[model samples]
Target chain A: MTDPAVEAAIARVHREEWARVVAALTRRFGDLDIAEEAAAEAFAVAVERWPRDGLPPNPGGWLSTTATRRAIDRIRRESQRMAKHQAALMLHDSTRPDPSGPVEDDRLRLVFTCCHPALSMEARVALTLRLIGGLTVAEIARAFLVQETTMAQRITRAKTKIRAAHIPYRVPSGQDIHERLAGVLAVVYLIFNEGYLASQGKDLLRVDLTEEAIRLGRLLLVLVPEDGEVAGLLALMLLTDARRSARVSATGELVTLQEQDRGAWDRGLIVEGQELVRERVRAVAAGAGPPGRYQLLAAINAVHTVAPSSSDTDWSQVLTLYDRLAALDPSPIVRLNRAVAVAELDGPAVALAQVDRLADGLDAYHALHATRADLLRRLGRSAESRTAYDRAIALAANPAERAYLTRRRDQLRG
Target chain B: MARYLLSVFGPTDPPASGGSSSRSELLQEWADTGAFNDKLQREGHFVFADGLEPASTATTVDGRGERPVFTDGPYLETKEHLGGFWVIEAADLDEALALAAEGSRACRGAVEVRPFNTPESIQALLDS
Candidate 1:
């Protein structure tokens, strides 16, 4: 094999086997730092030897064996210098032999451990991407717009906390799985949101992040097939992602949902997402009267996706679902979304009232100002609308959204 | 198995319970807590647990300098002060957290759980 072919093969296998190999190493070694370093060493060796020796037929198996040996070597080298190396060896006896870490999937155990609540939310997201998603520290740092050293420190601190605090490596038991799963879902959703709208940056959409989040969501579904919210979250992401291309105009301006061409939407993703929405809804109706927040959000997205045009959307259904979501979350963000539905059903004047009530709570949120600007524009309050658009454009980070808002502000009659 | 420190924190300005009925209520609270302590000891999770005196009684002592320094008020001044704490042994963080939850409910205050350092954690620091 040539160098390029070997590199490609190594990259492909690295993406496929990183989490599995690391998880297996962690399960065996009971130490994340060792598992991580050993995996890196194993990959480097593959890069060095695979070109000369030809790619191994069972690359993943070979990588796993090599990484385990590296970890063993690491422990031995360090153990020789320490006085209490015997005790550390016992501590490394694998954090309570899991009754298979629930499904014998090492990847699932790794994901859950990375998303443990003991770590800060940012740390959890960074660690999840690095450890389970197999993203390099530099890539994660770039994705989150943080310095490489900062991200490295964040990951290191989290690993230290996990070991020092004795966070178990196995998935939470039946009694605690639901509560723990919520934390894991929140981290994934945050990554998706960062990709969806993005922070203050030149790029409006982070395709890599949205893709990574969906991948994690799919993995979660396989690990916990019975979890309705897992299905709901995946559905919501897919439904939202279907409109990614139409979200930005060819001329480099943001396209609002009302302006996006529904004809260009991804039919396959829409179908998959709507199917999950149906399953979640049926399960929720049969079991509990109120669905989880993700389920309701997915249902709301289902209504929008089913509509041929924004005007044809079922505003009443969207409003009802938003109301339910507000009851559960009571967040200003939910009310802002609910106000969008109200704008369609009632007059913009009514929606403006709701948005105004949220002023104190969402003063710094760019979407709030954007929504208010649109409401004012619809009400023919040109001066107020112009002011609101200016506020939104100033607060907005995504260059596309800023350009779109800038055009709106300039278009208004003085 | 590991040891954890579950510290109960509450607002510094607790409502002054001076009336006779309030005093009896406090007594009843103490009785309930006493029963909880007994249960912990019976279950082998207890090491030591105690409620703290008011923060006003706390004095500060700093000995890092050549001569030790004594201050009048509590070492740390904050809106919320440590009201009490428990030193309990449990298997892993989940067990410790569960125990802290029950302890928090028993004392009617927020509890913060932290693990005591082990040989590995200390070695990790040295090795790093």
Candidate 2:
């Protein structure tokens, strides 16, 4: 018999409180494996007992306490085999002298751990998804775009490194904070990138990853409230998320902004995003520092969202923001986006000139070809446009992109 | 809350062959360490502790299901094999870090601290 009560409790444990509990227990139990085992034991107990006895008022707290006790017991049992086990007992004894107060913030500690610089970028993403995102190895593997076995090994190796190096579990301070903060942002950005454009799969977007990234951004904002850049990043994500609904048609076809139904855009998200951006800008202007890449991106997005129609978009403002963004973070991708704004504000010829100046490395890039084709077609260069469209079609990876490119080719021929 | 895993690694180089007296002294020190572990168990903070054999004895298995390929090597090809580990719970990273120091002293080797994944994180990924 499938017990609804037990199932519901498990769902609650997994959804609403598991990370908090695990973090709290992990704070007490220094070892990841032991902490995991103890937390599992607590969950097992909850499965067996929660149904019989009503769920505790604070299930998370109960789980944390239970897991802590189990960890202590496990430590005691293992003490017999090694010389250092005695010291382990001593440390355990000293720490548990008082358990009356509420459990400290384990989630914050977890974030710092996930963002540990000792781990590689891949390891950091994998570990963050594993520990902070609470994903299974198989799920992480899928998100990682790799084999499950490979991901599992990566995770295990990462854990071994943690065990071997004895990486501390706390938020860094002073100068160390800046370096660690970058690691933290990188993981958050990685999650957002995956959501913004899934590298594989049929879909262009993964809303779940996007939403999760936003959630983590929100959490980061809470943890580091004074950081205008963090606020800026949140605003940027919100603005991007606001456009998700209009990004595609009901049939899952890609819908460019000019063609999208402006009415379908989420007004609430746009408003929230605008306020966040405005607040961050004001804060930065007041003396926090210069606006960051995220702030600039948000400013550009705000221009788009504030406009009543596609034609009403403040191209000048977008161009200005793009210029600032490019200056702040010079990248080929940023230049590509800037070219679009230049095309609108100036002319196809100017945009084409700008594109030509870009490095030859982008010759194989689909977006480069796509943009060239669009510009060429607008200039009435049909044969050149068709050739560019063909190149785009060849370089395009996603089905929607291929279809879009093919459609452009047909239009050029017509 | 903070969590850390403290581990002590055995030296890569084996103890040099020596006369009986030096060997006896090393064995005595090893025995003292064993009793120290028993004291740790009674205190109730130990998660798991195991002494691994030399790196040469390690066998790694890769792949999954039907054909898990077995290879004769440690998971990490490095000389630093995991000799033993203990998971300790602490109130914060500082506290967990302090325990790591103590762990090193007890085992006569280095100790590492790390946090575990929480279930919330697992669901967060699922939600993503």
Highest TM-score: which candidate?
A: 1
Residue B73, model 1, lDDT: 72
TM-score for the second chain in candidate 2? 0.74
Clashing pairs for predicted structure model 1, backbone only: none
State the RMSD for candidate 1: 2.8
Q: Each candidate: what lDDT?
A: 0.88, 0.75
**How well is each residue in A51-102 modelled by candidate 1, as lDDT tens digits?**
8999889999999999988877777788634445445456656345567554
Candidate 1 lDDT (Cα, 0 to 1): 0.88
Best by DockQ: 1
Candidate 1 positional error at A210, Å: 1.5
User: Per-residue lDDT for A1-414 in model 2, tens only?
Assistant: 547967887765765566676666655555566666787788788877877787888887888788878877876776543234345445644665256884436677778887786678888888777666666788778765789999989887877666545566666766667657767887888888887767678888877778778878887787787777778888888988898888877766667777778888999999999999889878877887888777788888899999888889999989988988989788887998899999998999999888877738599898898888888899898998898889888887777667767876896755
Error (Å) of candidate 1 at residue A261 is 2.4
